[model samples]
Target: MINGDFNGDGNLDIVVANEDDGYLAILLGNGNGTFTGPFYSAPIFSYQISIYAADFNADNVLDLAIASSDTYTLVISLGSGNGNFEDPTFLSPENYYSANFAIGNFDTDTIL
Candidate 1:
């Protein structure tokens, strides 16, 4: 699971990878110790393991990077800044050691 202010609402929201179901579920925070949702992403048909949240497109909105072990793939879900995400964009890593990754401005060039 991962948590952040996904909707720019200043409240912490959550994202969970459903390993058994091959999808990601989001829970939007209400800021009063409560949350709502379980908003789902499209199925990946693989065993999901790790998830990373960041603004991958430099859009200032938090986005998602989901890793699946069973299929050896990584998927991107761009956020709409309103607790909603676009469809997943699938990627195949040639020699990934595990179903996990880190997000950062690896090149130190103001982008990720």
Candidate 2:
């Protein structure tokens, strides 16, 4: 599970990795300690082990970074600033299986 203000709504939201179902579940918050989702699903295949959130494109909207151990792919799903995500951008890394990642401006150039 990953938590962030993905919708730019000022409330914390949750995105859960569901490997068995091959999708991610989004739970949007109501700011009153109540949540209102599992509203959308982002489809993916194989076993997903890790998920992270950040504004990968510098759009100020939180996007998802998913690592799939079984599929050996890194997926970047850009957010729409309204609790929705676009279709993922897929990447194949040589040693992706069972892999994990950290998101940051690694080069200090303000890019993630």
Worst 10 residues of 2 by lDDT: 92-101
How far is 90's C-alpha from truth in model 2 (Å)? 0.5
1-112: candidate 1 lDDT, tens digit per residue: 9999888999999988888888778899999999998888777656887888889999999998888778778889899999888988877665564487888888999999
lDDT of each: 0.85, 0.85
Residue ranges of candidate 1 with Cα displaced over 4 Å: 94-98
lDDT of 2: 0.85
1-112: candidate 2 lDDT, tens digit per residue: 9999988889999998888877888899999999997775657765788899988998789998899888888888999998888999888666657458778888999898
Name every residue pair that clashes in candidate 2: none
Candidate 2: segments with Cα more than 4 A from true spot: none
Query: Per-residue lDDT for 26 in model 2?
Result: 89
- In the order shown, what is each candidate's alpha-carbon RMSD? 1.6, 1.5
Candidate 2 Cα deviation (angstroms), residue 50: 0.6
